[model samples]
Target: MIMRPPGKSARALLAATLLAPALATAQDAQGQNVTLELNAVEQVDEACRISFLIQNGHDTDIAQAVYEAVLFDTEGRVDRMTLFDFGALPAARPRVRQFVVPGMACTALGRLLINGADTCTGDGVAPDACVRDLTLRSRAEGVEVMG
Candidate 1:
């Protein structure tokens, strides 16, 4: 027997199913937001590695996040910045991620700034997530000047 084509309602249902994950990836639980915090910076060889803590203040779990961290030199100029893409940062307990900038040393940087977030989502992050006002905290232990 030949299979019949799916009806209008069936087609609509199929489309929704295919698009659910994309729509669900940007929503937060009860409108609660997530923020990024710079935890530590270290230099290994010729590269500098910056670690951050992603806090999901919402009740729901987060699946993906994109953020940029800006590094300021001793002269108060933008030394280097890197965009970080995170995966499955759970809610409540903070998650940590590290970003590396090659041919750089931590000794020359003054501070790390959480410049902006591209997107962050529990269900689905809003289009304005990047523009939303958020706080940044720096917990750098100490820095040493390299010879």
Candidate 2:
């Protein structure tokens, strides 16, 4: 049996295999989706203050993004539903938005649901871009966030 060096095609295949992960990472970044995190929850002046950390990972700037948010009580029952306006999300930028729900205690919050995108407008953004492929996370204790 005789063994020889790899041919040009084999070398090319090896190079592609080595670069596959990097290419995939770059492609993912370019087509990344919006990420929303429940950053904090607190009580202020007899109200529940909800803070959200949002990052626009898309390639286009978002002029306006409003979601229909539903808040669940500690018993896992829907407490209230409201609109959250996350305005002007520039691409690759992270922003924080806070909303205060009057007459609600922070401890009463169990889950936060993103029902859907009520308003999603941008130059190159699709009609369902905001809700489509959305990434949701929760950093606040005792609170679960889901889309």
The C-alpha TM-scores of every prediction are 0.64, 0.81
Q: Model 2: how far is 80 from its true place, Å?
A: 0.4
The reply for model 2, stretches above 4 Å from the true place, is 1-30
Alpha-carbon lDDT, every model: 0.67, 0.93
Per-residue CA lDDT of model 1 for 5-101, tens digit only, reads 9899999999999988876675443235566666788888899887877676566566777776676786778776677787776765678888777
**Predicted candidate 2 versus true structure: per-residue lDDT over 6-98, tens digit per residue:** 899999999999999999897686466889999999999999999999988888999999999999999999999999999999998999999
| Best-fitting candidate, scored by TM-score | 2
Please state the error at residue 48 of candidate 2 in Å: 0.8
